[model samples]
Target: MSATTPNGAPASQPKKTPQIPKGKTELKILMLHGYTQSGPLFSSKTKALSKLLTKALSPAPYNLHPTLIFPTAPHRLRPSDIPGYTPSDGAEGAEAEEDDESDNWAWFRKDEATGTYLGFEAGMRAVATAIADAGGVDGVCGFSQGGAVAALVASALEKPHREPAPSPSPETDTSWLPLLRAANNDAPLKFCVVYSGFYAPPPTLGWLYAPPIATPTLHFLGSLDTVVEESRSQGLVDRCVDPTVVVHPGGHYVPVAKDWVLVLAGWLRKRYDEPAGTAKKEEGNL
Candidate 1:
């Protein structure tokens, strides 16, 4: 259950890939599921993709052993008196009812007007801790609400530190930058992959200005995604500097196209395989 890097160093090993060969870095991906679903469900859907990536790149030139860390969404009650609590997918509806009965599990609830199930600040802190526990994350990937959260984390990590208040001049306002810098002091994220995610404005973020996230991001969208309109997703991508976009001809679900997975896998490999100093140099040029 342990992975090794190209230099024969041990990497984060998941149970699935028990006996990985030496000189291959174990690629640990933290996967956050979309709204109305849990981590296990997300893991199930991506099992094939994970296996394919693992098999395709086992040694040397493409040495990457991928592991998925699926975190459960915190629980919260469904909004009372909401007429259309039932999901379009029958299976999802049943699962929601089951959760309601158990009084646990939800990504977010509009009934209480809470933006996210665990509250934005608390949720980000939890995610940060999880990444740290994973020996520092290689990359962050998510779907829908999870995607939005991932983007938020990426943005927070790249924000530069600002000076304290009480400056002599009124033109010097460095309060917000300081807060963001503190939040992201530990590790800088390498890249991000977001599926069916939207970029909400600063007002929507409770007046918290989003810091520039220089991480190379890949955004995937379904042409017919009703839940998250293409325009909204594109807008989010537009805000990011030099983000890559992949469009699928399907709906809200992750594109089943094998090529997309391959591309993503390649991106991760390139980021992780390169020396840290080299990666930083390349990022600086960008």
Candidate 2:
């Protein structure tokens, strides 16, 4: 059939090419907040970094549009649960409600006596739901506790990363991995970026590092971070099969400066340019 113009005359059609160039590709990334923070708060802190990443990836051959999805942790902390939180004398009711509704959130609670991570599974479940809702994400970036969760998410998506539990117990819930895998349609994450991350000390989660994580990871550490020690971040670095570490002078925060953002953008570009199947081969090597 001929195409008709406004005047009812046949219009010429352009010839089709043998191979059409692909349109702009979306690189969806999950952003996880730190302990005592919410999604919006995290997003606001990383606004500059996000913008730089978007600008770097949105051009020419890359043609990648970076979409960042920030998801708050599911666990809410009580006044007592938060470090250094103190209620005013006789403060109650509305004051309590107001405090509860504010910036107190955690991915998991540390069992002080045993160093176990409580509520870890539930936190991962929330992340899995977020991934499914987004249809999936190419990668994840997190700060503090959320950074630890991001690493765990990377570990969970790759099945071979699981080794026998350090001490297997029937009570341990290892089922979240399947949920995460299914949520991402079994496609392993291309990368993970963690700021002030630490290793989960719980034996139940030891399987996560039974074989160190294979997904390419970029870890940012603070020289004077009092909240999460530099050693803690190094402990996590030691557990990654491939890790690129960046040390900044700041403390316990993601660096939003253009210089640091460019480092991340450069690393991401390299990962994106790697030939297909390289990631799987790297995973198999472990």
Candidate 3:
């Protein structure tokens, strides 16, 4: 029988509604802040980026949703330790031992001569504790020095294909391994996001890069960034087995504009939708 809408004429069929994919589980990402910045500070800075990601990836075309975790570094920094430090006019030029501001922190102190991080183990352990407490993560995202740590942390989670697993170096602290293992639950690191990141030039850190990490990496480089220098960020790209590069027209800060954020969403969508090592497929296009 034909149905009518209060008339003899037959009612037209209703148009079909579009179906949207809903992800079964949300992937977790541990976020690391840049030097002289705490997790909370960085989180505040990235609110725009996070909001854009949610809008772009949570419905319709892209179904991937990510939960981000931000944890503070364990090391407290002195005024001298921070970049762009300026001594006060008082005290006959004698410096204050501690900064009154509570937010001062660093993932590690740089040894300019040797190109080594003085407290990498302590800093990484602090990060690991945060992840372990959060019940693990699927990826890591970081900025500047934190971005460098993201790469190192990813490499550390990866077991070298052929190695005896030797002891930690004399200059480096290895206490982070236990917590790192706990944070990852013995699973491979799925992906890493680096903003204005660089390669760790120290000989002690060679192990982390020698094997060439296979985790899908999305690296953001600022064309005008004087702090991390383009060469340094490129050096990191050269070390990764597969990396997705996004160049922004700005400086040291993370670009949170719609265009940049959408680029990130697209990369992340591919990360979730495609298998590992397939990132190279889109290399030419990017």
Local distance difference test values of all predictions, in order: 0.62, 0.80, 0.77
lDDT-better candidate, 1 vs 3: 3
Write candidate 1's Cα lDDT for 1-286 as tens digits: 3343332222323434245568877766778777666666787888877777787667678777776777655534453323256455456666656544442233344334534233444445446545655655667788987887777666656534212325454643333333433434555567889999887542445222234456778888888888887777876787676677777788888764578777666666667678754543443222
The residue pairs found clashing in candidate 3 are none
True-structure lDDT of candidate 3: 0.77
- State how far residue 244 of model 2 sits from its true place (Å): 0.5
| Deviation of model 3 at 123, angstroms | 0.5
Runs of candidate 3 exceeding 4 Å displacement: 1-24, 60-62, 91-100, 159-171, 275-279
TM-scores for all candidates?
0.70, 0.84, 0.84
Model 2 misplaced stretches (Cα beyond 4 Å) = 1-22, 91-100, 159-168, 276-286
Tell me the lDDT of model 3 at 148: 95
187-250: candidate 2 lDDT, tens digit per residue: 8898999999998877777778868898889898988799997777888899998688888899
What does the lDDT read for residue 61 in candidate 1? 81
Candidate 3, 78: how far from true, in Å? 1.3
Candidate 3 or 1, higher TM-score? 3
